[model samples]
Target chain A: MKASDEERRNDAVIIRTEGLTKHYVLGAETVRAVRQIDLTIERGEFVAIMGPSGSGKSTFMNMIGCLDTPTAGKYWLNGQLVSDLSDDQLARVRNREIGFVFQTFNLLPRATALHNVELPLIYAGVGSKERRRRAEEKLELVGLADRMDHKPPEMSGGQRQRVAVARALVNEPALLLADEPTGNLDSVTSEEIMAQMETLNENGQTIVLVTHEHDIAAHARRQVHLKDGLVEQDFLNEPVETSA
Target chain B: MLLFEIVMVAMGAVRANVLRSVLTTLGIVIGIAAVITMVALGEGAQQRVQEEINRMGTTILTIRPGQQMWGGVSRGDAQLSVEDAIALRAGSDGLLKVSPEQQSRMQVTYGRYNSNTQIMGVWPEYFEMYDHQLEAGRFFDQGEVQGRRRVAVLGYNVPETLGGTPPELLVGSTVQIRGIIFEVVGILEEKGDAAWIRPDDQIFIPQSTAQYRVMGGRDRLNSIYASTETPEELDQAFAAIDGIMRREHRIRVGEDADFNIRNSADLLETRNEANQTFALLLAGIAAISLIVGGIGIMNIMLVSVTERTREIGVRKALGATKRAIMTQFLVEALFLCTLGGLLGVAAGYGASELVTRMAEWDTSVAPEAVFTAIGFSAAVGLFFGLWPARRAAMLDPIDALRYE
Candidate 1:
């Protein structure tokens, strides 16, 4: 079967890196947080970066999410070279191309769920009406439509994480980056978030998750383990079945 | 649209910390209130001085007796007589309208009611010089002054003080001044107070009547008033008066005369200058308070930025540019100051009203003062809000996100 042009574009690689490295100077000692890591994440793929303490998984995730620039490396997101982009340009890249789900949920406590979801759109200069419509649609998609007006403090851990997922998806970014997203949740809530992420991956959303939990990493179709600032192993895995 | 969102975000942040925000704005409020109230009082005092200058006749010069010296030794007193006034009137080439005045406090009675009143003796021209209007009867003419007629023009309140008789009824009636009977020819209208002079409470009569009949034939006059039609002619009138007075007093040329010619307008202008200086000094002090208030805003804004560091990190991660973050905080500071300015203006207006009611002082709140007060407060916000906003904008997203 011949795929259409849009399908071919969708099949293209979403992220490519060559010798991505990051170093932090702590007084006199130089700490190499991420070193000589080469990785690629294709469209419609779910990948988990797993590591223990003192590993470089978090630093790698930060560089991939466009929150930090690699000290020495070439990196591209959706075929655009973004390794040396200025701070403001990188912010734009993060806004348009990457959606971040931090471990802390990172939702503004004072804003409603709907408002939290609408934040990226507001930064994108969307009109209020259209922004509200898209935010509502995303919240509904995450099964939080009835709790749209609820604040983060008023919601459960699972519900707040779902709101974070909704916010991450609201901009329709090319890649979703979740860093220890289930770290603060109980096992049941973590399972629920992982199922939701699996559902999103099944629907052709590219995702890169960072976690130290083996079971959480097991949910991804591929796993890359990092040790001491280098990739120790990279392999594929059979996706875990979702009960929902 | 983005700007609007940012402004709303700033407003939400302020609303979240209601007590802190209110306490932060208190400094600006008191500062602006002090500025407004002080300026209002200064402007009010200036206006009053201007009114006094206008009322006292700007073109009029009063010639008072000065100490006469013989080789720098003091003479007990020098005199200005009716002749000096007549000489000024005749020799000024019709440039001056002159009147000699002699006043004494005396008891006046009418219909068994008596009151202590100020009795002023002068020419008919005195009424015109002071812009005195009559409520009833006619002013005694020059003929009455030459004839030493026992006719008087009562001031507006004289009738009320003398047993509450009406002005029109008092005119054409006989009243005794120092037990001497005089006919009331006219009643002057209410003139209000002008500086130290209260024209509304004195009784005016012919100069001859005062000198020969009431003042025990005293020939020494108190002072002579000379006026020019226009302010431009005042200098010429002054020179003429100086020459004429020197000749009348028989003093030599280039020697100091035994009299001083003071332009009433100049005296009032000096007083006005002093009033303005005092007002400006007060306004300056008030402006210092505004600066101190601005410093307080800056301090609070710094604390707010530090407290919201994590929020700033989240916003930056969500695609907020440095300019956007800067604008958000700046708008917050500006909003707080503008709000304080408005409230301060209200409080200041109330304070000025209170002063007017309690102290009986005339206070005019100029519209310009209101506008300037608000504008200055906004500027204060902008000036003081810059550093905190810059610090917020310069924050590293990763560090901020990691801040505990």
Candidate 2:
């Protein structure tokens, strides 16, 4: 049966969070890392969550990425109630719906760029041929096709980040969650990597990045600034001024 | 991706850490070699003993006229006689060959050189029936036995002591036995010593000469050597001999017979039992080395798990399952053990050969030992590897990724 535009629009509500909160105990005192907050993310949305250090951005990102559970709230990803799932089920959710990119470009040091890209596909149970094919295509999209066999150490910082990006896209997940995706790279390399990510987001890939740099956050269509573990500002980016 | 891929990944991991892996497997190699070589040595020694016993003649019915002591059979008096031998041989049904031997300590003098040696009086057929080969003149004829000729056949040691004299000269020469001159007629082949008798130091003479001329005792004979037609007839032959001797000696059925019958098969059995015990002891010692090898594997695996904490974290973060992580490390451990087992098998063969050549030990590496070592090493890999593999698998991905 062909789905109508209304059904497709309703499917836009890919990830939803209601009063999500996380608390941790340090010695005898409880530290509320993520205060109660409500958030919703739609499919094909490019979102940037900007925050200062220790502002609970990482905690919220972890919960949203399914790497952690919210202490006092519910999180639903792809219509599944994720906060109530077992560890294994949560891991499956992360594998199927959430692709994470760390600031350090956490590609396995000894593994080839291609192998790094194939990791998510490996967990998704893609056969060897399909995994290789899809990983090659992803690396090609990230403009790292010629460097597919290079290990992380052999590649430049920008190249390594691109490989990480390719790995994040390999599973075709609902959200690409990047934590300071270019934090360690030089300005030129960081801009080059950000351009590739912008291209991906323009092609309808949903991306969520945590960053402190306004220049890097400018690539996203929507920005959510957080301070003191609460949302301080939310805004939309104007259309790219091609004629300027 | 799959189990096979995971195993391949593990193998690649071991290959990357070649030196560490080899060092871990060294213990197993030594253990396998020790077990195989030690067991082979024990088995070889036992076979030598059994061969010695078998070559000493068969179906030996020893008639000792002593009484039993506290749970032990004492050496009886030499009350056996030629008449007893004749009676048993003539009356037995399955009798093929029988010889009553008398042994006495005497001085053998050839020219001016005199040596103390055992002088044995054996029948004419005793030499040939016992696998004895003559390196010189023929044995005494029937005429010489019936005539009670004073003749002696020198054993290997006696002849050597005589300055390697030619067999013909020794045959015709007169050797004084107990101050009486006895002509040498035949020289028996070199038969090595049994557990009790050193044949090379003994001289053989006719039973007539030993009993009537030299011993001057008519009623006593030493132990008798007998053989049936075939090994299968030994029991029947022994029964017939025992029955005849019992009847002739007038021993009633209720009384214990005046002899004990010892068979070559029994000697072989004893030797086999000793060999089995020796083999077990050797295997036990070797197994300790294998355990040591297993410990080495465990130790190295423990270190590897710690060192690869970051890598494990990355894999976990990348969606590798706990089972996949566990299987990867376990396969690496198994691979290490298998390498050790292969090298140990080669080392065992080399060691066995070295022992055979250098120490003159009879060493034969058994195929069973190879298979056993391989299996044991694999078991050790699995057994000792589990804890480390589990540790790798159970690590928290977040904490592991954070490990410096």
Docking class of 2: acceptable
Task: State the TM-score of candidate 2 restricted to chain B.
Answer: 0.80
Candidate 2 global lDDT: 0.79
Report the lDDT of model 2 for residue B112. 79
Residue B68, candidate 1: Cα error in Å is 6.8
Error of 2 at B369 (Å): 1.3
- Whole-model lDDT, candidate 1? 0.90
Candidate 2: residue B178 Cα off by (Å) = 3.9
TM-score of each: 0.88, 0.80
**What's the true lDDT of residue B163 in model 1?**
92
The best candidate by TM-score is: 1
> Candidate 2's residue-wise lDDT over A1-244, tens digit each?
2552343246677767778889999999998888877777788888899898888898888888877788888887867778887666777787788787888787878789999899888777789999999999999998988999999999988888889888988899888989899899998888788787787887988889899998888888899888767778878887664211
Model 1: per-residue Cα lDDT at residue A176: 96
Where model 2 places Cα greater than 4 Å from the true spot, the runs are A1-13, A17-38, A50-56, A69-76, A79-96, A121-131, A212-214, A224-244, B46-67, B70-100, B104-118, B123-129, B133-176, B179-202, B215-285
